[model samples]
Target: MRMEQLASRLTLKRAGNLVCSVCWRRYKRSSIVHQWSRYWITTRAQSPSSRPSSSLKGPAALGTQPTTPPITKKQFPSQLELRAVQRLDVLLEDCQEFLQKEVVPTEDTILDALKTCRKLSEYFRSVKDQPALSTIKPGGEAGNLLFLDADPADTQTASSRTLTPIAVGRMASSIAEEAMDKIAETIKRIAVDKNVYITSKVLQEVVDILCLLNRPESLAYIFILYSSKPVPKPNQRPLKYTKANPDRITAAIPLKVAERALDAAIKVQNLPLCLDIIEHTVSTKAYKRAKTLRGAFLPAVAVAMTPGAAYIVASRLAEMQEAMSTSMMTVIGTAGIITYIGTTSTLGFIAVATANDQMQRVTWQAGIHLRERLVREDERAFTDKVACAWGFADPRRRGEEEGPDWEALKELCGIRGMVLDNVELMEGME
Candidate 1:
């Protein structure tokens, strides 16, 4: 009977209908506890005590003070800085356009634009590199401000466009008195800071512009800068325009430009500046030796003329003694001395002032120093634009024809006896 009962219990447990007494008791207890927990949670949510703690409030909760967000300082554009960038941009564009067309901007346009550049540069410095600058509008592609890159792809156009605004502006007409200081500053930046190669054309144009502006002193300063290989800062390591400092790096500027610069200096009566330009221009060894020899001009002329004057006076005195009264002799002697002295003095003056044999290959009066240099260098293009500002003869129709008028040049220069002899004229004469 006991075995049968045990077997029946095992079979019931395996058949999945059997539940353990301990498990049934635990289930009843869990159901009651769950009900009670749900009731407590609902009550807690309704009560004000379950609200978020004030101690857990924001950034202040982590032992930190509550603070307002930082204010970003606003940037305002400087009128000067904005104006400078805009003016520079436009001027550069106009220059590039003119270069592309193989033409030049009008004198007025160039002058105004350059003045703007000067003003811009002035303002930039006056502000002491302030960050408050206006944003420049997107224009065409930005160009090289210092120089034009040699583009191999467009060789033909490249040669034509071998110029920059700085180059063009440096050649512009009539800079103002106030803006004069800025010129050296700008050039120093170009020469020292940016350190770009100033082309021959650019330098030639500078000569032309300086002539127009009547800035011979400035021209002399520029000539010195040109003479330097990597141009020095103004007043720093200043190079002397002397034969001792022969230009080994920079290309020699065309003789025509030198002539123009000399003319400008002479017009302003800046003799020292004139001499400096002359010294800087001519570098040949023969000229150097000849310059040294030229120191004897006064002595030579004095020696030659003193005897002639003495002979005339002595001969007059002897003749008067033989042929006239004391009073008449006195008058004749005085007249002869005066005439001889005056004539000799005048001739000596002319020779000293105008002779090419002097230390200065070209004198202030002769105005042919550069031409002489060209001839000595055996430069073939003696009549070219770089040599003289004339074509062989007038190409205009007869009545309207305008050719090289030596008289007009003389009158324009206002020099009493201006002698302009070009290599072409000399060659033709030969």
Candidate 2:
């Protein structure tokens, strides 16, 4: 009877019929145990040590651990930084356009624009390592300020578009005096700081602008910064041209600076500055070498006839004449007279002779006879000075020591006897 009851209960439960509570509980317990067994088996199968090496090689595996994603580096500016740069670009563009229209901005406005430009320049230098703010053009009616890059083709056309102005002209107008003062200050600072952006060419352009504005005092300050100790600050006082500071523009320029400034002054026809540089060159013994003396002579004489520059001209000419005489003698003693004359004539000696003739004419016209008398009076002494100036060893002192080999010296002088005769024959034919 018990077996018959049990079998009947089981059949009812499996058929989904009503069952006793104890039998239902027993059925749920068995289902739970089966699930637990399956889970334990899965856990053992997925153990990392039990996994195959090939399976672990790929990114996904049965027992693969969760990995932290790689950290990436940021290479470029952020959106906010880029937006700020764009704003700066727009500000510079507007400032440039305003100055290009020949309308000088007020002192405050100019300063603000310059500050923006400098900030942008600093940013560019830090980020890009280039002179970002240097592309300013001095454009407008007078065109007296620094110029910006322009299309070469557009320059010939009346329909050419106006260029962007990067910086205001120092002397754009009389009111720009304060702006000019600030520029001078900035330049001095740049020089002291040795800022690479303000290149020698850029400094030259600044000097050119100062010269154009007729600011000799400020120009003098620029030249002084090149070679003097304790660079003097730019004076805020208005520059005044006066007799006391006649050559103040080039007053403290060093030899190298003076040489370059001479060319610039001559180009602009700044007679006083030219003469001042010449005097500096002479007084500094800067022309002690034959190469430098030769290089400076033509340019010095080119301006010698200018009113107050006559003395400078005459002095340079005398020195040059003396040097030439000494060089000629040295060459003749070493290479024979024919080779010396031929060599000298070819290498600008003819030009120097012509310049001498021109100098005589200029002196005659200007009523300057002192230089002529001085040259004539000290001819022998001048020759000796030239010889000494060139550091030539005295043959007399050498006594019995062999002098310079004439044949060797002649070869070095570069003309053969045959070539000389051919040239003479050609001249005769002509």
Candidate 3:
């Protein structure tokens, strides 16, 4: 009762002044007390006891009422966020388990052995947490905890032994197909989820594997493009398809894969990969992206476009770069010139590659000339057109009459490095 009286009196004292402006000396304590009592008496209208209870019917009654509830731990995210982290942990564990038990081990011998071992080691590591209540059931009823140190040598790995060529080829194709299918699904899922969290290379091993497998085709195209500098005519089939069968199945499997690979290659801005893929695309005649055989020629425009190769050739073309024709240098002693255009030292990779290709054109002409000479030695004129394409000068005139430039051209392409001494008597060319 006394405590209630103290409370009521204190509340009244505090409330009346509002800002506590009343100085204790100027306003007598008894006077302030009288004013507060009067104010409460008027407000509550309760019994005039020493204890003017807060329960008295007025604003004072509700002033001491319990406030808006304080928030509990349940109302905040502290516990929920922890739960989410736990869920992610569980998801990771589940993924490990799925890979171990579900995925059939690949028998491909070339797959990195250490990588597969680490994969297994990581899978069963979560078994440490789950305490077992049963004896025979063991640590985890879901699955037996894999014994890490159980056996060493006998463990069957992906790279246990080298595969036969036939088996290796089949395995390679299967691996590629698997990766392609997986990546396709993954890309689709990412699109569906609108997810940006997913990354390339690490999680997308499947995609990387598939991309790497398609590398042979990529390499082939690079070789072809490197050899053939000039883009073919619009009428040319595949730009360099079997000149024999220019109109084959224009759209094929390898061609489609190569096109897709090029698309991805451009996105990542990978030069080596792009160069390789471009080479392969050209070699395999895999220009499925092009609607027609002629359309594939667009890639030719971009060939040797990489800065490292192109700028080096462009910047140092004068004294900076020169063709290295060692054979020509051997025949024509460097009188004034120390080294000819095709010398080993001065010649660029591009020049070497170009010369080699020009040589192939020479061989092709030789073959046609051989055929024509067999049928009719008469049409020497037709062979001249073929000869011109092979860096060969006019056939009508003698060497001196053809002029200095023509003679130089002839000297440069002399003998074509053919081994006439060891020529097989069986084959006519030999």
Q: Could you give candidate 3's per-residue lDDT for residues 1-430 as a string of tens digits?
A: 9876444332223323311121221122343221111122221232336333442233334344322211111111122112222333443444344334322223231133223322322222221122111211212322222322222322222223222333323332333243333333332332222111112222233233334333222333322332232322334333332232222333222434444565555455444555455433432333333333344355444443433443344344433324645444333333213233324433553343223222222222233333222222111222222234333344332222355544443443333322111223212444
Q: lDDT per residue, candidate 2, 1-430, as tens digits?
A: 9977654433112212332221222343342111110111112224456544431132234444424111101110111122223444466456546545433234455445445444433333222221111222123321211113323321222112111221111111211333334444443444333211222344455454434333433344454343332322223233222222323323333334444555455455444454344434433222233234455577466545343343344444445455457544444343443344446645654344324321210111123243332222222222222222222355333212233432232232232111101222222343
Ranking by TM-score: 1, 2, 3
Highest-TM-score candidate? 1
The TM-scores of all predictions, comma-separated, are 0.27, 0.26, 0.18
Candidate 3 Cα misplacement greater than 4 A, ranges: 1-184, 187-206, 211-351, 354-430
Task: Give the Å error, residue 364, model 1.
Answer: 15
lDDT score, candidate 2: 0.33
Q: After superposition, how far is residue 382 of candidate 1 from its true place, in Å?
A: 16
lDDT measured at residue 95 in model 1 versus the true structure, 0 to 100: 48
Better of 1 and 3 by TM-score: 1
Q: Write the residue-wise lDDT of candidate 1 on 1-430 in tens digits.
A: 9977543332111112331221211221332111110111111122345332431123233343434211100000212222334445555565445434422234454445445454444443333322211221112122222113323321121113222323222212112232333443343333322223344655665565445544557666566566554532323333322232333434455567877877777677554565556556644343344443454567678667765675566665666455667566756665677677778867865665444442211113444454343233312121122213322344232123244553443343234223244333242344
lDDT (C-alpha, whole model) for all candidates: 0.39, 0.33, 0.30
Name the Cα RMSD for model 3.
32.1
